[model samples]
Target: MVENRRRSEEPLHCLVTGASGYIGGRLVPELLAAGHRVRCMARSPGKLRDHPWAGDVDTVRGDVQDAESVAAALRGIDVAYYLVHSGSGAGFEAADRRAAEIFAAQADACGVQRIVYLGGLTPRGIPESSISPHLRSRAEVGHVFLDGPVPATVLRAAVVIGSGSASFEMLRYLTERLPVMVTPSWVHTRTQPIGVRDVLRYLVGSATMTDEVDRAFDIGGPEVLTYREMMCRYAAVAGLPRRLIVPVPVLTPRLSSHWVGLVTPVPAALARPLTESLRYEVVCSEHDIATYVPDLPGRPLPFDEALSLALRRVREAQVATRWSSASAPGAPSDPLPTDPDWAGGSLYQDERLSPVDASGEALWRVVEGIGGENGWYSFPLAWAVRGWLDRFVGGVGLRRGRRDTERLRVGDSLDFWRVEEIEPGRLLRLRAEMRLPGLAWLEMWVETDPQGGTRYRQRALFHPRGLLGHVYWWLVLPFHALVFGGMTRNITLAAVKGAPARVNEARAVRIRGDRRTRRTSQR
Candidate 1:
């Protein structure tokens, strides 16, 4: 550990944009633990409210797209961490450029002493035009910050191997799911992957440097290996059987992306850029960062150790943040759902209410622990098939399981949905993020019945977009009877101990005055 010295200077005030994102979320607590005052900026501040360290720092509700908000967030900040990125592969470079320019200008105008940006690494000696769009955007953004008035330190890194990170997850799913693979030629291209711990250490160390930093530093793990080797090594470390990778020269990036999308939770849009970048070597070409932050607690961890640490987090469900935490670029804003009639669409729903002899607390406990390793209460094989289908079609799938087993709060990702709202022991509403023809929500509520027992209610709502939406609903209605019906029945069985619970009825619900329009079906 670095010695914590009593500094004569005042404690630095830091601002972290994308504080809800993977790296940013993890970095906030690190800065706080180091005794520096931190301000977290997020577009949706509600998402950050229930974080474990929420109350420990100040939060500014704002987006980098808005100049005024960026300016406000930058005010009174000594050091700023720009950790935001556009993961959408199409036309994201332009958006990233605009945001970076605005942030740089705001930081400069606000007199921020130092600005640090995390960017992707492009190998030395390659022309700028030859770089992948993703890496190109990152390099350009770094330049924007460096060219601005403030002294900027840009740290370029390759794939960060961490649990919940997109790259790590892609590697994980590919290795674990496929026994033999026809891989692309890029798999043999060398890359210097770094662990998240080292990346965070370098970031925190940057804050304490006495000398001014105005240039870019390339950072990576000590070992350099090809993508194919990394995958085999990962499988070896995880104790999986050896995976056979048959390399092919004809598979294009689009084809590789589709293959990856089908096998992994990653979408084709996000996977394409990453696939393209793998064609070139990404090993670090310089060691300038060591001069600034010398003798880091552990300069660099071994590849096996880094891979194991990430896997351990996955197995333990202790992932701090995910790459998908931030909203995608150009995605329409999802406002808090209001009344059903006001929603402006042909809305359809599947509702189930069951009366149990158990207390509200017991029923709520079962609902809260529905997804992940708990196995969806019932029809686990069906659930797994659905998740695989979603992944096949480039949807999020169920790979992003529950963050916690028993406790949940708003903004938590449960399987393929996000917790839109939660009331302890009373209600849980999850907004769907999976690929769908319409918007969807799964809500569970616990209430006390007049007879002094608990009533468990489950609702799945969908607001269709067009004719295809209606068709999709009808097509899946038959399966819902099996999947959703079994789900309600099983949840009741799990909740009610010793005392038998009775299924009340299934109803078709539309949001609005509850009693107005309801069609009940008795089992």
Candidate 2:
């Protein structure tokens, strides 16, 4: 057994998988701050480049399913954090089991000192079969690690309350959007929610656990509250009118998830598992983690305090990572086809060019702040209708919004589209995530015309999958003038009409608001 004192005295080398994901992305910096050398492994390493701590840690392109890559990533690592999970879906359990086995095998082969994993908190007396598939799979993964040759520390948590997290987003939208909600019976179920800060702290501290202490630990916030209580508290924290929640037993997990999909940014696919997990009570059974990583003052923040912190981050747009940080599975990764005569089937494009009476900087500002509360500058009804239709069909609606109102990174999600690429003041390209027959992309460019004026260029590209895809594109072709055309004309007009001043004013207000918040917290 490794001595805890010896392990704590030396800085350990850590390997963090799923570095592009929500928890993993935030964990890298925390580990680095604790004097550990970190290496990050992701399927797309480029996705992690935009993070502020990207340069501080080494990154490698690797997937857990690939044994060779996993082995290579685990090489020379004292501790490995298994943060990757096949989010709820078909065959996710088998995939998760296989991935865990491969990870454990590699970690053992590499002589890793400890394996740290974050998993869902299961109800104490509930049978395994009664648990949701998401939680069941997580438990199986934890078992794989604990029963392996290497020592493991599995931290089980209920819903994580943080700005931009899926669970918190669901809670925020439901409570804020619907003043009166007919909620599922699960809303009455009790849960011990944890803050993201505490989760990260426990994850980092788990690295030096004694070898004999290979087991799962229940970690959660200081208070245990029902889902209904959480929603009420969330509304209070957000300074909104108290929500009236009516619990109805008729709404099963499936029906509730679909309802949540329609109302929140989280789509049905992701919401289903979350809603299902809420069916069981998940209060923490013990606080054994404090025995090893002693809690400091105000440690494991109170539920209301966590909610306040999350709300503050959302209001200030200081969110470090979002649930949308990870790319949706099967999202198109192909670069925009530049060749007109390419052999990869038909490519359709609607191009719009307009001369702006404003500087290029002004035009770029309007483009960057196009979505979220600043509604897309176009036929408002058309965009809203389209977003609703997408949501109805189990797609990510425009409600997902943008991570930051005034800025965008490469992997940021903008409405139903993901930022594929962005060049500071020149270009911004978005790839569609809404369900469609084929692939689609929207590109906006700010350039200087030959006449020394600002040129705003917009293009909508579609790559059809089959005959249906081609037909689908043509069917929507007639509305291009009103949809795409209006976007172009209105965007340019907004840019010319005091866009620079508006942007600066908004920035100033945000800065002032942040200062006030800091002073209040201090007082």
Candidate 3:
């Protein structure tokens, strides 16, 4: 009888599309915590392999636009999550509609019981014809799922505030960078914003609701505030000083997008959609979700509380997912080039060498533990500025750090870089993941000198795309001097000082960076 009861207590199996996306990445862990089995579908399954919960669920390699892959993913899935959106490039609306049609058809064919989709909250008191393309596409996708044969629940939310979220980052940078600003009239447009944590809760909870929930439900945080008010509240929570605002209607969404593109990490494509949507107010029109799923144990977090949570995650360096995790549309998914001349392209390099009176193993320890809590072995302030700039333009930034301090494996993330090669005590290669105009890499290695000492080589290599890449490198060359030169000196010094107490030979010696000794490495 016990065996029979155990067999009857099987968990529900769910398939999550867009597993590489921001909310989808976080949603997998939440679903697992809720005792449901999850299957993540990604165009490149390798992208999900590094996630903390990677081992907890199954992954299927597929795209929603491909009917076969969709059917395969939907096989035996009780609930399917449609979290994908093509709101970036040209004709994204048509692309979104086609993807939704294919997904709904496949889910129905696979006999999935219910489909749960997350979309944007529609603007209130506005005609459908005048609705922003971003919101309109989202609503249409939700409609496709609801109209399918399977029962479906559509959860529409406003801006989601969380660490690494594109929407939240825009607000964060704008408020932090500018104490006084000329703003568009849309800054005063009232809208409801929701915490990512609360949104996740609603998403996970909706899976358990019965088929009686077949329509759309609007979800949001407890407060309905203007974008201006939200930014001010964020500043208050973050302990930032009061900001001055001047409203101006002359700055249209296009102009605002360009300005935001320059200031924030979000590019013009994403910024345009966001700015367009902000022209109208987006508040929860119905309380159906509250009645259907109910609040988790306490009142939902207000704007300030949510903003605090996001900041805490950033401070702790515990971000589970970033908005940039999704692979670029045509980027190569394979590991970055490790061979110096693997690709035929124009190359420029900066190389530095430091002689250390330590063993190769000793030097390797310092190199392996270069990032994370140890910090970069150079101009930390400059590194922080670059990281901030990267984050503003939708790059990974330096917040990711290293997965392991004492050790590294190929494919591990080191700050805004991905490890491409690790040769034990000999070498380490990192491919830049931060937004750049060209391909770049930082390589380091330790070798035994013929004179019974350790020699460390550090090189920064770039393959320019066009004039932009060349200008970018030259523009930052001076900063690189302070960063790279100091980095080489400090790394060798750390190796010498960090040598075991018994190694008196290493402990007695010192090293310093000499830019005059610099030479370009083979590329």
Candidate 4:
């Protein structure tokens, strides 16, 4: 077709197939502030190198049912974004219909110029009966991503409020810790939810609508709520008060996604594919996305100002992630969670005083090359803005950092601490992955007590797992007593205040809420 109408009149080269998704991480910064030329597609492009749209993207790791990484992320791609999904694999609808039948037969032999997809909204004729199986495999992966590419728009959204959405962080943790709820009957099922800035303004207004090929709109947010009136409009935008919801029709969606995986941290295979795709209904009917966003003004902000801007973006914890595929990136979690809010117990000690010209094997080769992707020596952009504000209020920040940067294991993941014990010249321990209402630790030790020389000890321990973990460690004990007493007086004034402070393999990090990152050895 004239090379698909000369590649849809050039100027798009996009290819965002679930580029580390959550609506392709907010549609790659609205398709790069609308200049287009994305190409993200991931199986982990170096864990999306610090995404904020990570340098306006063009990455490409693989797997869209890997046909050579979706034919090299659809070579010369002009447009192809069918967002991958695999809510806990092993035949996730035959892996989302064999990855949309192998990226729609390699985006139809790579002449691709269009295919945008982003399904969810389900109400049309209102006969969604018993619809589960993850919303009928998300409506059969939107009919195999509009069967074969090049001319497919499909928006169809629903609960995408944002801030690391797991249906808006399980309604901001059952409205900030069960203020008083007992929800069921899919909480009253209705839903129209939309937000993430109106699903990136209807996927960048369906990438400049060109006679909406093979279309399928149905967006949302004009309000039609119900998940217990959107969790009392997110407890009146988290100021709380009004949660008295006691429906309880035999709590099930596998026991409310395991009581929403114990008061929220949404994991139960991503909260059972977000509670089995909300039984049904997701408003949005004609008015054709306001006749194509007629200046996308108002009328999409009720339900308590979109749950108070999605709980002020999860209490202003500035997240930039919502990773799923059940936390892939070498997935393997389940050896610790005993749900007393994820069991805790820790201790650490680190003491130092050597720089008569510094060298305990060069400070144990900079604390055994610290974490993965080389980082964590000292204040890395305040530890990546406090691990993107603890992943924007849902926790587990700086994403478990150590996957390998100079071998030193015991259940790795070393950013939000997880080494849990190591000794190269004297102990090192860590365990908190941020989420403490109880146990936590970051121990470090290196001795020489008889006064032969060194003596470093650094500790930040906590074991509060009950009275709301001792009222959240005495309400963050004076900011964890001034960030662990000013980070052990700035690592002993940078070991005599100078030379030996350079190893940011890439800006070291591990800090958030009384900040952190520990592991010290010298001799």
* Top candidate when judged by TM-score against the true structure: 3
Off by over 4 Å in 2: 1-5, 316-523
| TM-score computed on alpha carbons, candidate 3 | 0.68
Rate residue 385 of model 2 by lDDT: 95
Model 4 residue 339 distance off true place after TM-score fit, in angstroms: 25
In candidate 4, which residue ranges exceed 4 Å CA deviation?
A: 2-14, 17-21, 25-38, 41-48, 51-75, 82-113, 119-150, 153-157, 160-163, 181-187, 191-280, 283-429, 432-470, 474-476, 490-523
Q: Which residue runs of candidate 3 sit more than 4 Å off their true CA positions?
A: 1-10, 314-360, 364-487, 490-523
The number of the candidate with the highest lDDT is: 2
Residue 176 in candidate 3, Cα distance off native in Å: 1.1
Instruction: Return the TM-score for candidate 1, rounded to 2 decimals.
Output: 0.66
**Runs with alpha carbons beyond 4 Å of true place in candidate 1:** 1-9, 314-523
- Work out the TM-score per prediction: 0.66, 0.66, 0.68, 0.36
Worst 10-residue stretch by lDDT in candidate 1? 331-340
* Each candidate structure's count of clashing pairs: 0, 0, 4, 23
Clash pairs, candidate 2, are none
Alpha-carbon lDDT of model 3? 0.77
For each candidate, the alpha-carbon lDDT, in order, equals: 0.76, 0.82, 0.77, 0.62
